[model samples]
Target: MVVMKKMMIGFLLVLMALLSGCQMSEVYDTSVNLCIIVANRKNQPDFSDSETLNTSLKNVIDSYGKVQIIVPDGAPYIQGTYSIEEPAKRMSSRKAADWRDIQISSMYNILTTTRAQTPEVDLLSAISLAGRWLDDREGEKQLLIVDNGLSTVGLLDFTKNLIRVDANTIVEYLEEKEAIPSLSGIDVTWVGLGDTADSQQSLTPVNRKNLECIWNSICIAGGADSVTFRGDAPSTGNNSESLPEVTPIDIIAEEPMEVPAKQSRTWWLGEEKCQFLPDSAEFVDIDATKSLLQPIVEAVANEDLILGFCGTTARAPGATEQGCQELSLQRALAVEKLMLEMGMDMRRIGVTLGRGYNHPYYINDRNEDGTLNEQIASANRSVIIFSLDSEVAEKLLKE
Candidate 1:
C-alpha cells in the first residue's frame, strides 16, 4: 500500500508539470483588429475582376473561423478572433507560387468579365474598398496586406513574402521583414506575402484627388454601371507630370476666373471706385468686368481655393443700380470662363453673390479729393477668396 501510494503521487506531479508546460507554451486567443489590404497586381491582365477576386478573398476569409469580414463600401468591416489551431495547417505547395499574382488574377477576372470594368478602374475600386474598411472603426489596428511592392516605416524598408499561411504567421513575417518607413497620416502595421505592402498610404492630398479623378475617367471608359468600377479606372485625362500649368495670379485675374484651393484663408480684394456697372450702359460687359478679378482668380488656382464675389448696391436714380447688379453677374460668369481656360479644374470652383451697399469694406466711399474715387467706388464692392467647405462644396458640386 505504501509503495502504490508513492507511485501515484509521482505520476500526479509529472502530469501536473506537463500540463503547466503546455499551458505556458500555448498561444492564447489574440483578439486583434486587423486591416486587410487587397492590392491589385498592376502586371496582371485580369487584376480587376471583382467576382474572381472576391471569390478568392472569400476563401481566405472562410479558412479563419474566428474572423468577421468587414467591407466598408459594399460590406461591413470584419472582426477576426484567431485561434492557434488555424495556423497549424500549411497551404498546398502547388498554389503557393506568387500569391499576389493569383490574387490579382482573381480580382481582375471578376471585375473585367462580370462587372465589365477595366483593370485600372478595377484596381482603384479595390483600393478604395480597402480604405473604406477603416470607416467602421477608429484607433490602432494591425494592417495585413496581400499585394506587391513596399512602403516605408519611419525611414526603414520592410519587404515580405505572401504564401498560404495563417494570420499569425503573416504577422510574424512582417515583424521580421525589415524596418519600415512610417506611413504619414495613418498608423498601422504593414505585412506582405510575396511582395511588400505597396498600396502607398503616403499619397499627397493633391495626388489622392488626382488618383480619384483617374479612376473616374476609367469608369467612364469601362462603361461599368457600378461606381466602384468607376472609382479605380486608369487616369486618361492627365498624368502626374502632365498636370495643367498653374496660371499666374495676374493672368487669372486678366482672364476673369475662379479656382479652388486645399487650404483656408480669407482673401479680399478691394477697389474703391471699382466700377460696379460696366463701362457700357447699353451693353454691360459682364465678362470684361470679371477680367479685372484675374489676380484673385489666379491665386485661387495656385492654392486650392474658393471665390465669393460681392458688389455694393446703391439705388441709383435710374437703372444704374440694376445695371450694376447685372454687370456684377456678368463679371462672375467671365471669371468662370477664364478659370477654365487657365487649366484650373472647374470642379474646385464655387460661386457666391454679394448685392448692394449692404456690407461695405470701407467707411468712406469718397476719397480725400471729395470726388468719387474710381478705385474707392467699387472698394465698397469687392470679392473675397476662401476655402471651400467640404460639405457645402460637395453639395453644390453634386447639384
Candidate 2:
C-alpha cells in the first residue's frame, strides 16, 4: 500500500508540470533576478563603484545574461523578452578558467553600460519597468539603483519644488496618483543620493536630508521588504556632456528673485569671481575681487543694513580641521578689508563668519582616480557678499 501511494503522488506532480508546459526541472528551479538602473545625468557622477556588492555581481550579472543599457528619457519598457543565462557550473580542467573569464567579461559590460547619458531622466517610469523586468525571472528578486536621486522629467521633479517639500507628502501624492512602483518582495539598494558632480550645484546638508527622506518613503510605500541607502561617492568621470544635456536641479534653496520689501538678500560671486591660491586667504587677484565688489559697495553705501561676508575654505593637502576653519575665517576677513580700502563704511560691515569646510558650494572636487584636484578646490573656496539684493543695483541704475 505504501509503494502505491508514493507512485500516485509522483504521478500528480508530473501531471502538474506537464499541464503548465514546463519540464520537471523548470518547474522547481528558481534563479536570481537582478536589475541595476543608473539615472545619473550631466553634473551627476556617471555610475562608477567599488564593484564589491556580490561576488563580482555574480548570480546578478551572469555569463550570457544580456543586461540592457538604458538612459531613461520617457516611457521606459523592456525592449523585448530576454533569457537570463544560468549561473556557471563546474568546467573541465581544460576549460576550467574559461567559465570564470566569461563572467568577468560580463561584469565589465554591466559597469560600462551605465556610463551612457540622456537628456531627460524619467526615473519613476524606469522604476516601474524594472518591476516588469523581474516578474518572469526565476529566483529571489533584487534591484540596485545607482543615481543622485534628482529626477528631472517625472512627477518627482527637483527643478520645481520637490526638494523643499516633505517626504511623506510626496509619497502620499504618489499614492493618490497610483504612480508608485510595485517593489514588493524585492530588495532595493540606492547609491549616491545627494552627491553631485560637474556643473550640477552641490547640495547643503538640509537638502541632502530631505532627498533621503523622500526616496526612502517612496521605496517603503511601494512595499519593498528591504531597502538600503549607500553614500558611495562616485568617481569623477563626467561623460554627461556628449549625450543630450539633462536639466540641472537648483541646489541653492529658494529665495526671492525680485527684491523683497524687508529682507537681507545674498549674492553669489559666481564661478570665476575670486578663486584663491591654495590655503591663502588673500584673493588670487586682489584687483579682480575689488572690481567685483566695487559696484556693490557703491550701491549699498547709503543703505542702513549691515553687509555680512560669509567665506568657506577648501581641504588642501595636510590641512587640519582647525587650519581649515582659520583659513576660511581669514578669507572672509580679507574680503572685508578689501571693501574697506575701497571707501566702504566699516560700520556697514557685519560679523564675518568663515564657514570652512562645513558648507561646500561645489562638491566632488576630485579626479577620476579619487585624488583632490586643487584647481577645483581653489574654485570652491571663496566668499559671498550679502546685505541688500541685486535690486539695489536696479534702483541705482535707474536713478
Candidate 3:
C-alpha cells in the first residue's frame, strides 16, 4: 500500500512538471504580426506575377501556422505586401548642382491616405508590429525588412527632413486624426533594406521573392528574434566594366604650396570611424579609433600638413573644466597614436588644445537640467583642419 501511494504522488509531480514546461514553451513561441509590403499593381501587365507571388505567400504561410491576412479590416497586427513604382523619389532638395538625374516621383500614393504613411507603411509599421511581442519583462524587439532602400542623402539632410515633417505636417495629422503614433516607442533590432545587398546596385528595391524567403525562414525558426536584413540594389547589367586609372584626392590634409591661396579648414574622420560619439566617459574603442586614423595616415604620407583639435566639455551636470581638459587630452593622444601606428609623419601633423566650458555652436543641454542649453561643443572638440592664415580662416568661416 505504501508503494502504491508513493507511485501516485510521483505521477502527479511528473504531470505538473510537464505542464510547466509546456507553459514556458508557449511563452517563447509568440504570435507575430508580420507586415510585408510589396511594390506591385493589379491592373498593370505585371499583374500575373503578383498573383503567382500571392499564391506562393499563401502556401508558405499556411504551411507554417495561422497567419491573419492583413487587409484594411481593422487588424492592428498587419501582414500584407503592397506595391510601389521604380525610380524612388528624392523627398529632400536636389543633390547635384545640375539636378539632372534626381528622381522626384512618389512611388506610393500619399494623397489617398490622410497622413504620410510612407514612414509608417514603409519602415515604422513593420518595426512597431514586430516589437509588440515583448515578454513579461517588457523586452520585445523586431526586425525591419524594408522592401525599399533608404534615402541615400546625407545624414543631416535626413534628420532635417524628419524635423520638418514633425514640425509642419506629420504632427498636425496625428493630432487631427486622434491616432496614437504607430512608431513612437519601439526599438529597432535590424534594419535590412533592399539597398545594401547589391554590389553595384546598392540603391534598389528589394524583390518580393527574397523578402518572402527571409520572412518564411523567420516564422519557421522561432526564438528570441534579432533584426538582420541585407540591402539589395537594382541590377543594371550582367557585364562588368573595366576600371579606369585615376588620381585619388587627399581629403584629410593640404599639401604645402610656395604661394598659398585662401584655405578652408574642415574636419572629417577617415571612412571607418565616422559614427557619432555620445560622451567621453566611454573609452574610445581601439577599432573605432583606428578606422578614423586611416585617412590621416594616408594623407600624411603624401606630405600634407594636418591639424587635430582637442577640447573638453563642462556641459555634463557634474563635469568640471579640469576633468574635461583631461578627457580632451586623452582623445587627442588617441588620435595622435593612431596616426603614428599607421606610419604617418608626426612632424607634419600638429595637435592643438582648445578645452573650454562654453559651447557657442549648440543650443541644447546635455545634462537635462531643463535649461536652454546653447553651447556649441563642435567648435571646441578635437578636429583635423587644414593650416591657414587668419585672413583665410575668416574667409572660409564666412563661406
Cα lDDT of all candidates, in order?
Answer: 0.36, 0.67, 0.35
Write model 3 residue lDDT over 147-266, tens digit each, in one string: 332221222112122322232243344346542223322222222332232132322122333333333333323333333444333333222122211111111222445775534444
lDDT of 2 by residue, 291-361 (tens): 88898888668566677777766666566767777887787788889889999988987667776665635
Superior candidate under lDDT, 1 versus 2: 2
The TM-score between candidate 2 and the true structure equals 0.51
Q: Find the 10 residues in a row with the least total lDDT in model 2.
A: 21-30
Provide backbone clash counts, one per model: 66, 1, 20
Q: Which candidate ranks first by lDDT, i.e. highest?
A: 2
> lDDT (0-100) at residue 74 of candidate 2?
42
Mark the regions of model 3 whose C-alpha exceeds 4 Å error after superposition.
1-265, 268-283, 359-399
Badly placed stretches (over 4 Å) of model 1 are: 1-262, 269-303, 313-324, 360-362, 366-375, 389-399
In the range 183-291, model 1's lDDT, one tens digit per residue, is 2222332222122112323333333343334333333333322322112223222122311121111101123356644555554544331333343222234455456
lDDT of 1: 0.36
